[model samples]
Target chain A: MKQDQDEFYVGYQPKAPAGIAGAVRGTVVLLLLLGAVAAFLIVREQKDIAAALFEFGVVREFEGVIAAKPYPMLRVARPDAAGDAEAFSRYLLVAPFKFGADPIVAPFDGKKVSLKGTLIYRDNKTMIELAAEDALREIGGGVGDKPVSFGEVTLKGEIVDSKCFLGVMNPGELKTHKACAVRCISGGIPPVLVVRDGEGTVKTFLLVDRNQGQVNQAVLPMVAEPVAVTGELVRLDDWWMLKADPESYKLL
Target chain B: MSLAYQAVGWNRQKKVYDGWLAVGILLYLAVFMVLGAVLFPSITAETLLIRGFGTASFVLLHVILYIGPAARLFPRLLPLLYNRRHMGVSMFVLGLAHGVLALIQYHVGGDQFPLVSLLTSNGDYASVVNFPFQLLGFLALGILFLMAATSHDFWLANLTAPVWKALHMLVYVAYALLVAHVALGYLQNHAAPVTTALLGLGVLGLFGLHAAAALREGATDKEAEADNGWVYVARVDEILENRARMICAAGERIAVFKYEGKVSAVSNVCQHQNGPLGEGKIVDGCITCPWHGYQYRPKDGASPPPFTEKIPTFRAKVTEGKIYVDPKPLPPGTEVEPALIQGEGVA
Candidate 1:
């Protein structure tokens, strides 16, 4: 049935006039076409999803030296390293669900421990989300640390929550992921300043105040916004650490 | 159209309408998710669900808004308007899904409560481009929920037509908030041309359709004054058989229907949804409403036996080849004699 101006439609009637029923059928075809077009355009327009991987629900055991400076991290020496590069690979450690691994790993600071956790990695960056309980148990080895200084410099980038950016959330930087970044950072996850070089090479630095303490709360207002910070760039093993007060950061 | 509503009155036509509606929604979601995964192989499942549901609800809102004006311009499209409230409720449910899942994925399991974190997580309230866009979406969802909760005819009857109408008018407010939500939330980061173009087109199309409908309605809204206790209607010949010509007189819209060689006048507002009664033709000896087909006898403005709805009727007469209506209304259900067109006087 078509929508003839002459045919009156009473919805309570068991049947629609043939013309209206036919017109509604035509409308359905039209709507389906519109839906297809919308779906294609919308999906095709998405920003690229990053090639990050989060090995969610697959638990693996690991052994490494714990470090609490700047943020909680595990330093595992690599036997495959060539000649004078950093001897160990630093795996950022975070507790499950929007929290830092500091409290869980702090008791074993500077001591080697074994733990079960999930791995979240992107490019060269890696992080571990520790099991809810019994995440770290000391395996009995002491650690000595030497920090190499890269000198004071000014760099520009967006601040992001390290756990999410490492792999937990794809493209987890800037305004789109700002709220989650803020939540993660506020809950004590390390804040990272992510700088991308002109050629698209990316460098991430664990942000800390001048005292080398956690700056998660201090950097909340700057998370996911492009900003510039001047600080001493130092290296603790394979991890880059930015030593600066949150007050020195400027919105770009 | 309903004597007593029971959740919903199931009719064959209504079942067909809902079945098609479900098909449309499922088709949209399937396309979005399947195509999204094929295109962005690394896209997370949660992100896909969020985007698919969010965009579907937003697009459906544009369709819902378009129906009212489109039906006015093309009355044959009235079937689309018959079950519009169902569409509203479905749109709200989709929106709720998008909102709740996005919140859980982002804000929950954090140190603060999810709602608290949602409000306090962003401090850029003063900046337009940097405003908390999620907050806009949250507020819009709240309004959508309110509307869906009160959508039943039971609420319409309890709240009174005017108040229910006024509450639902907040759809424009909700629409504005959603526009900002998209502009500030997604477009601020993505800025894809197709996304922006679609949003702009929906806004512009709605504006164009409504403006055109309003202009057409303005022509018929011209008021006629009374002379010697009667208001002049159109010529008797102007109203075709079993059809009506509407006139605004005596502070009300009166439909002067000519049927069976005689003329009668009644209030133009239908008892159901206040549909334009004048646009409907006489069906089975009763004046039918164009929207829901609620019927009333032209002589007394009363529904047939077993239907209690009624409207005010006016005394009509034909004189010197012209039709005239008394500028005062008889009580609802009061019977009035039909005017003889050839004899030029009320029978």
Candidate 2:
């Protein structure tokens, strides 16, 4: 067992120049430690800019009937004595839109329902994002039967998700957050279009199919990207709805 | 080569190599961050770090892959090969930073665990255009982690050289995955033609270098053989005393040594780590492996005694002032008499 190990050092016993491996390892360890410290120091807890932006939008609840077509919309009865269907102010109910019909809103169509969620207000625009479909509860009988008004318009903007844009991810929309935006939309987060006017003021819209159903897969590739979309614009509460034919939206 | 491990055997050259390597990596990262800030002022700091370090590490990985074939093409490049493990570990660090920053910026907001959200958030795997590109990057990073964590001689000794070398080969797999990660993720949104072109050119360059090196080696292995199954290698005067002249006969690399006026031949592949035995010389009358200082008897291809390592031997003869090696090789450790030349006194 104690045989000469030198026998294994056959022919040429090349002793290294003597300082290479150690210096290399020491340098490597030092660099790694420095990098870790720098990374830790540079990256701190980020401020919740999204929350501050959300504070600009006021929150409220509505008792209405759900528009369970291409996407979910709520037709709220006017608090005043206007009894006809025209007396209703329709508001689109936005939630994290997943694949297929939503389990909560799909069953409560044409029935009086109560929507309890945060209603965001910006530039005289109102939009509410539901934490879950359970926010839509049947309230015994149906409410608004008025014809849902629609107007055709062309809009330019970037498609983003309400969850991240409102408060979760700071400065969330752009080329960098594109993949995250795509994931949020695909995972059933309702997509919102942040359109900027000539005055640099911003307005947001919920993007859906022409019939206002889930457009998660249809616009999945276009998330967080700027584009021009021609769609039927509808007014629901303070929320602006863009029911575009999925094929009509073009990347800019 | 020592009987006991002492953590590491240090040398001045190794220290110098590591110092320069560290300086190069830090300088690269610093330049990247500075340039990013100046060029894209509106981008957030986190985004800059993620993209800057991500691209830097990707480029470094390509350079690491290019070093091997480059060294074969030019012996002067061997110094780069000596410190490559340091380069790899540095790359892993840069890559880990990019991955961590990306996770914090994108996936940490939701109620779901960030990793879980990354995997399940996008189920559009069926569409090529919408494939989960992040998954490719995630898997590649995992491979880099494995290679980095085990990148020491201690691991090499425990796992054995062949297995350790094989495990490190997964870098190629990681490279392929990273290519897809960039193509499908950033390029899709940014539409930068120049970046795409550069990626294509880097891949082509690596391919060209490897193919050229392989072709050269193949030519050496195809030299014509003599009628008696002996292949002509070199003239007796061409082999330096105490050194060797390497030859390829019947596809086997043989190192023929000339020492004390006698010639002996053994397989060039060292049993320790497949090091180039031909590059080593006869020291104290024993053949030594230059890589880790392993030694053996030139006559029988065997370790002196109590050591079990052995290599195959070949019959070498000198006729007409030239050295010739038999195409057939003998079993490992088989003893053979040394061949004597005319000018040299009978051995």
Candidate 3:
């Protein structure tokens, strides 16, 4: 085919304009210098962010739990006068209770214990969720009810019934699945306990919250033993919720 | 034929462009190393230097690739096209710095050997949601390094143009790999949406321009083919004073210049990589390619500086107020300088 000789030509040549090579070299040098400076700044910035987060009390400390148990009702009372009396409360309509290894057990009528956890405020109220270590410690022993700071107040309570849930039909009989039911519930939701007043009247209480990939083993064989559960005390409606410290929990 | 038409053949290079390229790259590395050492004391200065250099190099490579296409679309951008290899090599150095630093950071930091860590660190390779894209970047960089290392004419001649071109095409693959690297590694880790978008837009913009050019070429191919052969159909006003527009005939584009009242015809494609000379400007008594600034004297088509390629020139004559170009090509490098007419010539 005849190639056009009157058409526009566009092609690439390896050579550059006079002095442009020098200019490009200079520009690259400048950019490299600038990049080094920027990289240093970025590294410093990351360190600062990490430090700031640490200063803000975001890093949690492991503290022992004083006490724990599952109660029929939970509540969080407002601290101020203007705050609602019943801000957060969850009442268990049915109690499917179980003891140590038993499949079924009776509901926690009246019990009391102190537990410890990291208290976090949400919607203007405190909520406590126990960590694994704290739950285990609380099951071993119970604690006394002392006016503890938001950080170290371990709720102490007796496991009125380890398995506490509504009655469910078994294949053979209508036998209560109490003890084993609590162990099977998982999520540190076993070793159910009841917090009670001086007159033995059931008051607010705490329960175990488990993490993923963990199973609730048999309750501390030392039943009725006092345990210190350090975590956050979350006050709901009629009863207060205690989340045990996953790290800081010990059998007293 | 004109002097410009005869100059479109390959000429041996007096000086290699690679020397300037190497020098520029080394300077960038030195500057990066010194600055990094001074600025970052906590981390090993070498690592920072390498990373900084690599990033800058990639950016420079991108800029170099853009200059050619930019000059084509915008004639004024020709100046940027000059000394592009130096720019490319400098970029290569920077990219090398990045690769070396990344290897040190990812591989050396861990307890395992650097190479082992690079290959076996699959901790973050769980899902597409969090795929380890760095491995892909590493692979792409390896390809770029290979191409950059062999970017000299010596290698080009040995490898042959087709092989060289094919090897260089890995640039597109590198671009894609880099995109994935940034998206999965940096963006995911930093969660910086704005930065991600900006980088994405810059790369996408370059690709978009190339795609647009390809579409335009396809659309104009038929007209170009018709204009390539003997008969040149042009508007009366299209032929400017002393300068001529290239017309496509029979699938070829040819430049027709009217100098001193005489019209001459030559292949519009530059002998050096078929650069379009018709789009070039007549500067300082020479046809200057808008791409890479290669100058050729229009009298004999001889490239002036840093180039020695010659293209075929065709005979042309005006008949009955119409322009016609001969279908036959003159011998390669035939210095057929067309004479100029002194009297009032056909406008």
- In order, the interface RMSDs are 1.3, 9.6, 18.5
DockQ of 3: 0.03
Among all candidates shown, the one with the greatest lDDT? 1
Which segments of candidate 2 are over 4 A away from where they belong? A1-150, A154-158, A162-179, A182-190, A194-204, A208-230, A234-252, B5-8, B223-226, B240-243, B279-309, B333-337, B341-347
Ordered by DockQ, highest first, the candidates read 1, 2, 3
Best by TM-score: 1
The two-chain DockQ for each candidate, comma-separated, is: 0.72, 0.09, 0.03
Query: What value does the lDDT take at residue B150 in candidate 2?
Result: 86
Query: Stretches of candidate 1 above 4 Å error?
Result: A1-5, A83-85
Q: Give per-residue CA lDDT, model 2, range B24-120, as digits (tens).
A: 6666667656655554443456766787688768877877898788756754344556657878998999899999999877776444578986886
Clashes of each: 6, 40, 138
lDDT of each: 0.88, 0.69, 0.47
lDDT-sorted candidate list, best first: 1, 2, 3
lDDT of 2 by residue, A1-252 (tens): 222211222211233322433433454565455444333322221221232223223445677777775456677666673534345555545554222224567788878878776654334434456644357667777744433457888999988875556543445676446667766676666688899889967788878787667787788777766789998887655566798877889988
